[model samples]
Target: MKSLQDYTTVIRPDNNGIFAAYIPLLSGCHAWGQTPDEARAELIYVFEMIQEEYKEEGRSLPEDVELVIANAS
Candidate 1:
């Protein structure tokens, strides 16, 4: 079973200087804020909403999504 924490989260500052956070595996699951923490907090709310919707529709999140860290040499 996969939980929300199991998904990979990508956060970066956009050209406008707003912080954006999202789970790439979940389509339409993204949020933006003035800071990284704010963006992530909003994203968590969005995730909960999406999760509820999935539950209502009898759908389960994909099992293959996982967090990965890579280093650039």
Candidate 2:
């Protein structure tokens, strides 16, 4: 079973000063807020909603999804 912990979260600040949070492996799964913490909280809520939606639709999140972290300078 794929859980929220199975996904990699990417949070970054945009030029507009809003923080963007998303699961890169999940299409259209995203949220935005004024701070990184807020963005993350919103993302958690969105993820739960998405899970419920998929459950109602008799579908499951992709099991092949993988998470990779990289550092850039």
TM-score of each: 0.82, 0.80
Lowest summed-lDDT stretch of 10 residues in model 2? 61-70
lDDT of each: 0.87, 0.86
lDDT by residue (tens digit), candidate 1, 1-73? 3566878888999999899999988999999999999999999999888888898899998764556778998
Screening candidate 1 with a backbone cut-off below 3 angstroms (N, C-alpha, C), the clashing residue pairs are: none
- C-alpha lDDT (0 to 100) for residue 41 of candidate 2: 93
On a 0 to 100 scale, what is the lDDT of residue 36 in model 2? 99
Q: Please, what are the lDDT tens digits per residue for candidate 2 over residues 40-69?
A: 999989988888888899998876356666
Top TM-score prediction, candidate number: 1
Task: Pick the lDDT winner.
Answer: 1
lDDT of 2 at 58: 98
Error of 2 at 16 (Å): 0.4
